[model samples]
Target: MRLFLPLVITFICGIVMILHFFIPHRPISTIGDGLTDWYMIVASAAIFLGAANLVQVHVHRINTKARNWKYSPVVLIGFIAMMATGLLWGVEETLPFDYMFQTMIVPMGATMFSLLAFFVASAAFRAFRASNWRATLLLASAFIVMLGRVPIGGMIWKQIPIISEWMMQVPNMAGQRAVMIGAALGVVATSLRMIFGIERSYLGGAD
Candidate 1:
């Protein structure tokens, strides 16, 4: 009964959404809009559930004194502090919430990204090694693109920038479009499977 009901609901909602895109009739459109409103309410409730789950997990870890449990308090403290500030002072500009976000959160985010740059450089170095013809071509393309972005590459060879631009506009764009098309097809397939009750994995057991 549990799985059957959800599958029925999924089929109905999926058909309504598909019709909403194609038909645009008054009755279908009204039902689609109502479904969308219900989706928003469910999503809002899920956010609260997720927050509660996070707090519960961290509190359990702190209470059990699990490995690296000391860090859990930091997560809890940050979550509580942000919530308190936003609820008490509001998130408007020049308020405590905004001040903390700009001064503390933004800098921390920047620092994390700065640290990630080194990891990316390390990965790029490994990936750019000319172990094969394909790797050699990749290394060369990367070298040209990197150099083209700098002043020295133009000073050394004016054509470097032009080649880099062509590579990005031609091959890179083609690859991106291919990926997007594949992803769109995959989404369509998955949605159809779910609508027809063939994708039973969502019910908890194997499909």
Candidate 2:
């Protein structure tokens, strides 16, 4: 019964959603839109569940006087400060809470992305290793494209920009379109299998 119910619902819901793309009737179209909006609302509620879980795990460690209990107070305080600010003020504008979040959260998020610069540089170095003809060609193309995008490269070699643009528009776009088509087919296949109960990874591991 646990497995049976979800499969039935998935089949019904996926079919209804796909049909909505073609159906033009106002009532059916509205039902489709309403269901999609309800999905977003449901997702919003789950955000609380995630926050509750975080507090539960961290608070338990703090209560038990775990090794890093010192950090828990900071976490709790930060949470409370933001919550108080947002609850008292509003998210629509530069309320104190929103401002704090914008300044602090945005920079921290940006720093996280900045961390990727190092990894990408490292990966590019590793990815360019010329072990084979194909690898050598790819590395050469990547170097040309990267340099072509920069002003120094344009000054050094005026022809690279044209070469890179042709590669990007022709071969790269063709490969991207092929991959997208394959991905679409793969998604449809997986969804259909799930709807038919052929896939059950959602159910936990064996007992």
Candidate 3:
């Protein structure tokens, strides 16, 4: 019942959400917005689950005397500090959060985002060789995009903008639609598996 109910709800919600985009009718639009607002509230409530899991994992590691367990201390302290700063000092002060946010969290988040650049470059280098016709085309497309985006490339080659525009309009649109179709199929398959009780990884494993 637990599994069946959520799956049915997800399928119905997905249909409503998709239709809401095209229909533009009052009732369907209202239902879609309500579903979205409900999601936000539920998501806020569910964050406690993530916070609880983090504490549990870190505490266990510390208790077991794991190597470099000191990071857990930093995590715990930071979590508590942020919580207290928000709950205690609050919006009136605004100093603590702004200080920590601007100096610590923002930089850390930006650095984490920056790390993706290196990973993407590595992936591109490995996967984007011209060993075949398809690979060669993909590599050519990516090269045009890279050159079009950068100032020096634009300076050196004035035609980059025109090529980039066509690439975005034609190839990108085709790729996007293909990706969306594949993704939709995957979603339907997973939802079906959940509905049929075939996928219970979320309920935690085989007993």
lDDT of model 3 at position 103: 83
lDDT, candidate 1, 1-207, per-residue tens: 878889999999999999999888899999999999999999999999999999999999999999999999999999999999999989999999999999999999999989998999999999999999999999999999989889898999999889888889999999999999999999999999999999989887467
Query: Model 3: C-alpha RMSD to truth?
Result: 4.5
**RMSD to native, candidate 1:** 1.7
After TM-score superposition, the amount by which residue 119's alpha carbon in candidate 1 deviates from its true location, in angstroms, is 2.0
Candidates 1 and 2, the one with greater TM-score: 1
Best by lDDT: 1
* 1-207: candidate 2 lDDT, tens digit per residue: 777777788777877787789996887688789889989999999999989987897899899999989998888888888888888886766689879988999899999999999999999888899999999999999988888888887798899888888888899999999999999999999888776677777765122
Q: What is the C-alpha lDDT of each candidate?
A: 0.94, 0.86, 0.84
Clashes of each: 0, 0, 0
Worst 10 residues of 2 by lDDT: 198-207
Candidate ranking under lDDT, highest first, comes to: 1, 2, 3
* TM-score of each model, paired residue for residue: 0.91, 0.86, 0.69
Which residue pairs in candidate 1 have backbone atoms (N, alpha carbon, C) closer than 3 angstroms, thus clashing? none
- Supply the global lDDT for candidate 1: 0.94
lDDT of 3 by residue, 1-207 (tens): 766676567568877887888988899999999999999999999999999999998998899979989899899989888888877767453578677877899899999999999999999997789999989989988999888888876798889977887899898999999999999999979867765556767766442
List candidate 2 segments past 4 Å from native. 66-69, 91-94, 204-207
